[model samples]
Target: MSRISSFVEIYFPGVAQRFQKGIALIDERYGVKAMYGLFFNFCLNVSRPGQVDRLHCLPHADYKNLALAVCVVFVYGEFNHKEKCWLVMWEAGIILQIPPGVFVAYPSALFYHFNFDISNLEVCVTDGADFPTPQNSRRLDGGASGRGSCVWFNQASMWQTAEIGVDTIKQAISQGLDATCDNQAFLDSLVFAKIMGDKGQPQPTL
Candidate 1:
């Protein structure tokens, strides 16, 4: 267990179990779990600390050791739903400006969500792509990485907020990604749009 995980478990016993139960509730209420066609692991884990915000899509299948998977992100920011179908996908939508200290548990693989410009953050949660089945028809960018969520950002928003200049843009490009390079060009397009936005010009629709 990570130092953070040990601390949480010792100081906050049953919290992981509570979240698991909550996922069950989400399944009951929105059937997010049913869409995966398999069960998910609620083994709480600590996410790597990040100071910047991100937005991206992902697939939950194969999140952990399971054949298929899902995840719940407890982030203090907006988590928008990319897909529309409830049973086949997470009940898709967006919750703007999510307050701090709030937990948003979700099937990170099943739902493509993004983070707003909330900074100095640490996301603490567990990998949940435990579904045992074939990959879904719509494959998310960084689903295989088990990092859940492409960490892709909304272009207009990222451009408007990050204050990313030529140097920053160059840096993100050098890494071959804007928050989620692993997702490839399909996701990188958002960064390009943001760059265009910085120019005060209309970005071409994807």
Candidate 2:
């Protein structure tokens, strides 16, 4: 089997009406696996260490051999990278407008960062773990060292949060399901395909 080292984003349409059901479906589809959702009321600030406060890279690569998938319901912000700016996209097209509710997904491994300028926007994050360990090295310069102690961030630990559940995730998505979210899912899926080591699949040049 190919090594899984990327993230995936899945988008749900009409998320408001089907938020809770979706979570339930995911749970039923992938049982006993640790699933988590993070909701943000305002636009999130995701930047390199010195660039922003709310944004920070993890100490080590997550899931070592798996991918992370994020389902965003609403987006009132944009993702800023070193080379260019990416406006979140929906199923229809580029997400230049922000609706009250939108859903989008994307891989978490690509070399990119995001920031939100709007208030009260919500984000739902669903993740799985393949292996966990303590980090032997710190992310001093925006890069991770391959060797280090490792710790596992498993399902039990994630479910401990009150805000993480099918209902909560669904609520966040129903709040916003726009084009940006759709585009994110597409980009993320591309990354996921690569990590899965699909033969003949084109990988992102980054």
Q: Cα RMSDs of all predictions? A: 23.9, 19.8
Give a tens-digit lDDT track for model 1, residues 109-182. 34544432222123222235554334422323221111222111112222211322223555766766554323
Model number with the top lDDT: 1
lDDT of 2 by residue, 60-100 (tens): 32332112333332322232222122233333233232222
The superposed Cα distance between candidate 2 and the true structure at residue 145, in angstroms, equals 38
lDDT of each: 0.32, 0.29
The C-alpha stretches of model 1 lying farther than 4 A from their native spots are 1-70, 76-91, 116-206
Question: Measured by TM-score, how close is model 2 to the native structure?
Answer: 0.21
